[model samples]
Target: MTAPIPRDIPDLPAIPGIPVLLPSHVPATAVVPPVRRPLVATYRLLVALIAAAAVSLELALGSPLRTLSHFAIQSNILLAVVLTLSARRAWTARRPLPSALTGATLLYVIVTGLTYHALLANEASPYMLPGVLTGEAAGPTGWHVITTQVLHTATPIAALLDWLLLTAPGQLHLRPAATWMLYPLTYLAFTLVRGELLVPGTPARYLYPFLDVARHGYRSILANALLIGLTSYALAILLVALDHARPNPLRHRLHHRAKTGFRLQPPVG
Candidate 1:
């Protein structure tokens, strides 16, 4: 018998019309009964706890009336909403999240983590380093630290870890990235309208310095917004690419018997 072909070396032969770039997971159309596993249960619970803590801290921002005005708080609220909703199915019935929801949430958190650090973090503070690393917040009080870091740092990291380690992949497509713009676009419209209505002399009329048209000039700010939107779409493309990079099928079979493993089996070239 040919010594069981070593899975470490892929043996795909290049044949005409044969698929080389096959999906790495079950097809999205596969019919299966809803199910729950202990491991999936654990992951869902962890995500729920993290999201809840972040939002609770947000609510404790000392001024219940004014807390939602800031975009950072709004985005984190959105993040909490998405994370909670995604976990519901698992929490109630022990099922994994749908691929599309998974991909969209992943992209949103990654974008959230990236945008805050790059464009908004306090460049002067060393603690701003977390924001920098997340590729990432500052709060005056202990609550601020928890909420801000959890929203900008911990939440994003948790969401990413949910995708990169605990979840299976191969459910995303290019078109959904286009759909992901709805939340951001709607939020932008709201921000602009609210900023315009603020008292005439308000210097920082806009929540973000970059979006403050009175200070930056409409032409300049619009250009910056357009550039950021383009960059966001580009990031969406990368998110789609990552979804396709499921753990290698060969490696899956090779290590099928492993228990409670957390290794990211690199895909074969």
Candidate 2:
């Protein structure tokens, strides 16, 4: 308190104990925004239209209630609805649908195609009019043939392409794959119950040959159901494995550019 402070202080030597503070440096990262995909939208929309048209043709040509009951028709209906919404989302750059729904839709449609070809194509379907397959009756001509192909072949291929080409990989999981079996199992129950309710000799009383309770009885039908269920579960497992193994097609280009030290630009709609 008694000593007076000097008016001017001499330049002091750097103190070893003092610490200097400088501005922190941060590395810049490129942020990519969601991009609208017109091509994907258009492709999905076309596929949806194809599925819808096939379902509509079936409804128009056959009994609406009976046609609607078929697994193939129901699966196609789901595909159509889901794809239509997916197309809108793609166009608007919205978040895609949950993996569970999209994966189930794909699996169901694929199963429909496989079932048609493996079990119903060469053989007579219960849904088909009597004598249609034997050339004894005037069989379905131009539009009917187109409808069948669209439902069983074209639509399935298109859906698979959408999954493989457009969507990101590794979204599917084993748990959902296991859960996917539930709908098919429920359908089995429904088919059995419906067969029981129908009168004897009712046309298409039991829809498919494998599930023909009158001919095969409950014992054989259950056995057939078990075999088919196991096969379907195996297919589901294969799909999950394939999904995880597949390369990331959607972001490869962006990744490549980033590695090459090029400025990454967002994709245009």
Candidate 3:
């Protein structure tokens, strides 16, 4: 006797020209009702806990009047989540990553590096080291500098996400929950290497609490970092789930093309 099909795999949609096969002469398209699995239950519980933790952290900022600031920061976080989720979906669906994401990431790194160099032109500080390492001499007066180290650090994360979601087929089955942990891991690595995370000698420190608190005390910094890691892992799971649930426009187009007997071919090299 053949083993029964797992329940989490949803029924295949009725796409014309596609054939379904099954073992033991059974029809693969036969309607097998979905079952409640223990894994799904655990996943849901984990999501709920993570959502609660993130909200608590945001609220713990300790001021009802700070709603605007909290909202602003959380909104950015949400946008990041949306972008990541969208990217993941596109990648999972086998769609090329929009050049906009890579471009935007690069642009941010460049702008951040330039801002660093501008702020600390002659001033010596740990922050200026990154600016020096990545930056190119701009004229005799140091009017502009290009920071390549910042790009090196940031670009790899983007490329990893792209590879995980876009290039690796069926990889999600094993690393679904762990993939999101990359956010905190990358940030932690950045902090250890830089001794200070995010922007330094910048006015934006008032807006960013975690980086602001790094100088307060070692215990406080450790606590905040742990919170960040936990919240990030949670958010990753949420993003993955959201991405899986949502469909992409590019994917739809590809499906249509595939149905019409269009074969996407690489240019002969």
Among these predicted structures, which one has the highest TM-score?
A: 2
TM-score of 3: 0.31
Q: What TM-score would candidate 2 get against the native?
A: 0.78
lDDT of 2 by residue, 1-89 (tens): 69998999999998898898888553233334456678999999999999999889878977787777788788999999999999998
The lDDT, on a scale of 0 to 1, for candidate 1 is 0.61
Error of 2 at 82 (Å): 0.9
lDDT of 3: 0.37
**What TM-score would every model get versus the actual structure?**
0.69, 0.78, 0.31
| Of candidates 3 and 2, the better by TM-score | 2
lDDT of 1 by residue, 149-233 (tens): 6777777787777666655566578987798888777767877888888886763456666676787788987887888788888
Ranking by lDDT: 2, 1, 3
Candidate 3 structure quality by residue, lDDT tens digits, 187-245: 54544445344466643333323334544555776675677556545544544454445
**Ten-residue segment with the worst summed lDDT in candidate 2?**
128-137
Relative to the unseen true structure, what is the Cα RMSD of model 2? Answer: 7.8
